[model samples]
Target: MNQPLLEMQDVKISFTTSTGVVEAVRGVDLSIYPGQSVAIVGESGSGKSTTAMAILGLLPGTGRVTGGRILFEGQDITHFNDKQFEALRGNKIGLVPQDPMSNLNPVWRIGTQIDESLRANHVVKGSEHHHRVVELLEEAGLPDAERRAKQYPHEFSGGMRQRALIAMGLAARPKLLIADEPTSALDVTVQKTILDHLDTLTAELGNAVLFITHDLGLAAERAEHLIVMHRGRIVESGPSREVLRDPQHPYTRRLVTAAPSLASSRIRAAREAGLESAELVAATADGEKPQETVISVKNLCKEFDIRGQRGEKKVLKAVDDVSFDLHRGTTLALVGESGSGKSTVANMVLNLLEPTSGTIAYEGQDTSNLSRKQLFDLRRKMQVVFQNPYGSLDPMYSIFKCIEEPLALHRVGSRKEREQRVAELLDMVSMPRSAMRRYPNELSGGQRQRIAIARALALKPDVLVLDEAVSALDVLVQNQIIQLLAQLQRDLELSYLFITHDLAVVRQTADDIVVMKKGQVVEQGTSDEVFENPQQDYTKNLINSVPGLHIEIGTGENLGLAE
Candidate 1:
């Protein structure tokens, strides 16, 4: 109705490669009204970010806008040169990049980075610049803004660093803000706060927001309008609520059904439709007694003594008297925000870190009391899958070697047997045998994670400590991995201690859930009980913090079985 703030008509972007030119965005049409919030949602390589980059004239490498126009305030700037673009960037259109770690300069203090943006845009100067930096940090919700401004990016936590980035992005009070996966790495609660702050700030400043993300739930919940992209083309576009409530495109439907937040209802539908396999259903049949405990953690306490400003020792209770049980062939998820001791508990269970107090029992045997040889042997029964697949895997090693290394170290099988096992492991993870020779850098994020999973399974471990294993993956890839883990649990009768900040994912994969905060267990219950009726205020807040939690989709009885 009103004049659009930013508009893209038939925007085409391409990049020159060794082979030829590859089209990244194909005639995508999108618009964001003044002070409006719009989201572009898609999986990886779907051109969501590419379209955003085109608007900012910041496409990397050999990328160039080959056709169409990007109109800002009724002017077509498609052919704008770097000098012209510089005049608009930061002052007119600000960008909050996806990865804060890579986006922020490591050598600079948080205040210095924000000040540079302010100075570059000529927004403030000298004493006023220093004051502006603190104001920006405070606006971004950073605590003790003045003190925090002196700290480097490394000194801040993941959420804090993201807040610093947000402060920098909004430092100039641009007319439009393009936040690319701004909260992907943050916990759900922290994500909610950051997004809420961004929305409030943008609305107050009359700034339009073009939010690019792979999270369908987040997009649906946060944006007024939604554009679903697939293979460089728009498959669906409309009000976010309308598109999500009744998706017309097959791809959109897949995303909705695959989303872990919505998957719990889908599971109910699958059961009612008898679409799930009989074995899989029977493995988790109701009325059956709970399985025996595989790993039991009791009174787990981890404390770190650090020197304070006055050089006095201060005790930080990373994990305080936390307790939980992982049942045989069941998943137990530890849900909490960053610094909430979820990972600390996981590391303790894996024996990667020793607890200051408490006991970790494996099949009734105290892990701390085990002899060196016994502990070494115990590693064969318990394994871990870390958060970052790329970081977990060695770039120098082939996929086959990565998987085979574990078996070789444990002396589990002969040379030929290990080779055969490697192939089988890859197949189990739905990877082809041909991928064996490829290095980590050659694979996609999902493929690399599968390789990591294969490596974890190589030892034939009965238990797995999956610490945010699928947190970094796209929704589709995350769904696939969740399904794979479900199947593996059924087939191998494996128990899992899943540690993550994603409650949406936990609802889908975890049978039992543990809610932790400040190194303490706030609540614990079955997934159904916890999700449907949370007992603790903290748990309620966590569930409420999940984006799209308010959208009530029809059940199997109403919408029929999901395909």
Candidate 2:
């Protein structure tokens, strides 16, 4: 491979804990050649992001490189000091962190951060720096880069901020680009767009990329090579197409099988095999069933006030007369584009925001006029996992404290009992008890999210509201979480109010589907019925817009579904 551009030889990372030393990444070896795009895939806590962080010299303060050699351009950069690493960082190896929401300085202008990232390693101050910043932004495919350069990170949308992060990463034309779950939070269209840009950039720059993600589909689509991590070691590594088509390792095969698209296919195949029909008939035999109605809404309305340029006010119906029912032990997915009131309905259900009009009932109880105490108790029965895990968690608290807070607030158990419960909850979420002491910054995006889910399940809530819980996760971790949710729902008979824009997730996770448009339910049915025979124009449009819809596994080329 012409002396790989970057190499990690027998890399090992550990963190000192009260109990003992915890090994995160163990005896792992990987390499990246010029113009090559390699993906690192694993479940949460598998050290995928840890490996990427090590590459960028951005590992947490508590972590130590127990043993390894990080060779960048054939030079062992493992022992590089802060000053040396800082110099090499942007100029040689740029990083696009997973969560741009917090990685970006909310107070600083986007242009300023991009310039700062570039100037950190190489000085180019004043107007020259500004020009270069704008140029980099343009190269990253951001529209009106010149004007956007003056705006703060908050002024930009999630996708725009992610593009800005990429622009910053490319500011120095680094030899290698490391993107950790770069498109994890984006919708399918935006995710495809981002990957397309990355592909274009790699081809144009001839720079190697270390793309860290869990989505096997995305990794297969974007990367030339794939590396699968399990626990702390590499289980599989090979050409993306080969590995994806015929994964050798059990872990890799499990990941591929767990992917939402692949899972959906399995579901379809099982239905064709009459498995679903038999299961549905058996489930139907459970008499009366209260129709399994977990959540019922009628004429739900939400409005937002937007001000005019002249300070005049305008009340807009963000969600208008939205209505749907969530059945017991099944996922009811709400799908729509950005600003489609999917989240608005979720917020209303959680009682985080008051609705403008209409009714929301849980288990035949009207929640519209509940008192503060009643609402608080209702919240205990229904918990939420937000879209951004980092934002949802308290930065100052450890994972243990974060999970414990909910239990304590609900007065579910005593101090010692709560501690034990917290441990069990962590274990239930497939996280180690040792994660308790680590802060949010100490964990990866997927780890933090698992903790968030654990916290939500602390009180054994009957209903769980997952608002893009798996959206920010890599494909592998996303699969694990999806499986976990399915298992948990089956075991506990828990109802999931899954709010998402991803049609793929809807297809896999949802039993019933609710298609929302302008805050109204345009179409509703079983997932199979909705996707296979979408009745409404809006629902059909959403299904048509799904990316990678026509990707062929055996053909090795575009399946040619649509552009």
Candidate 3:
């Protein structure tokens, strides 16, 4: 075998925390050979990302390599100074960070950022920078590179911004690329496209890839070797399929069991195991659905007139003729890519945004013609929990205050009764009543989301609108949240209008699925009908875009792989 492009032998990384010294990566041994793709998968704080960051000497805060060595081409650079690391960064080891919004400078044009990287690394001459910038963006799957190069990051969408970051990362054609959670925030279709581009680019250039992600399906599908880390230690390492299909560690098994893929509905024989889609359709045929209708949207249409390039009025129809029905004590998922009108539909249902033309009825009452007093009273029965719990919540507000604010706004009860209700709400979400006094900043992402759910349920509403609720959470936390939602729906008899871009999550939480695209409904049916017999090409494409669906993992249901 040829020598490794990069190697880490018994690498021990640590950081100095407020409490004491903590080891983040403990004696992890890894290797990335030339022209090979390797992946390290684990949950947050499992040392996968820490090991990758250490390779480029980019550990944040007080983190340091406490023991062992990291060798590049047989050269020891474990203790390389900032100057040495800079020379190695863009020139040889390029990095594609997790969040493109924060990574790219908001003030500078996208082209300027890529050009700056090339200038710092001396990859292109000053005279050739413009042409090279366009070339890089074009290679990164962007269209009309010239016009895109002149635009700022804000002008681009989430997928476009990520592609720009990839273009910048590979501007110098580095021999070894470190992609850290590159597509975590992207839509499924967008994520698949970006990963495909990376594969082709790496293969053509004969470059090596070190992929760091929390997605086991991605690791198994994208890389040759898989390494699973847990609690700062390597728990499992082998061929991707071998490790994924038959995990030895308990944590690995839990992770495999928790992955919410579409295949779970039917591994071999069933949508809900013994509950077949055909049978489900038959049982509920001829208007046999017994559940009561809670919310009804008919011919929903929303349009925005925006100033175009030259200040001319341009009509952008965000939601066009969309319709769906939400039943009591059930879940209805609106699934699609980003900007596919899912959120717009949800906003319309929440009465946060009025439709240009259509009707939204709540419990057989038309919500569009509701007066001020009626609207104010109706708010107590419908509530929403937005995406990004960090931003949805106010930093200055304590958990108790955050939950109490809604009750206070509605004037539901006295001060003492509100306090008692807040306590009960926390208990429902499984959060400690003691944490009621704590602030949002002191909690983790999962904790914040739990608090957000509790706050959403504060008014004892019958309907819950969760817009990308669990998209920002880790895999384990996401599973927990899904389970919590299930329990809440069953216990409180709440109906959920869940809007998200991930169909994998839809398979887990949604009872009825509505697939949208380009402001139109592409497909709508029960979970079994959609997953078992998808009727549209777009819907089929979305199912195929799931990362590890094609793998041969015994039964498709248990391992959650699709044929």
Candidate 2 lDDT, 1-563, residue by residue in tens: 69999999999999888998999999999989999999998877889998888877778968878898989888998877788888788898888877778889998999889888867767466659988988888877788989999999988878788889998888888889999888876766566667788888889989889988777777777788889999999999999878866677767776766666555544455555566433222121223333578789889998899986479998888999888888887788888876779998999998888989888998899898999899988988999988878789999998889999988888877899999999999889889999988899988877888899999999889999999888876676676677788777777788899989888777777778888877678899877789778998778767755543434342111222112
Top model number, lDDT: 1
All models, RMSD in angstroms: 2.6, 6.1, 3.5
lDDT of 1: 0.87
Tell me the spans in candidate 1 whose CA falls farther than 4 Å from its real position.
264-289, 554-563
* Candidate 3 root-mean-square deviation in Å: 3.5
What ranking emerges by TM-score with the best candidate at the front?
Answer: 1, 3, 2
Q: Which residues of candidate 2, in runs, are more than 4 Å off?
A: 1-3, 8-27, 57-84, 120-135, 138-147, 268-294, 308-316, 362-366, 369-462, 472-481, 491-493, 517-523, 534-563
Query: Model 1: per-residue lDDT, tens digit, 318-419?
Result: 999999888998889999999999998988898889999999999999999788899899999999998998799989998889999989888888999999
TM-scores for candidates 1 onward, in order: 0.95, 0.77, 0.94
Q: What is the lDDT of residue 23 in candidate 1?
A: 96
Better of 1 and 2 by TM-score: 1
Error in Å for residue 248 of model 2: 1.7
Displacement of residue 398 (Cα, Å) in model 1 is: 0.7
User: Backbone collision count in every prediction?
Assistant: 0, 4, 1
Candidate 3's TM-score: 0.94
- Between prediction 1 and prediction 2, which has the larger lDDT? 1
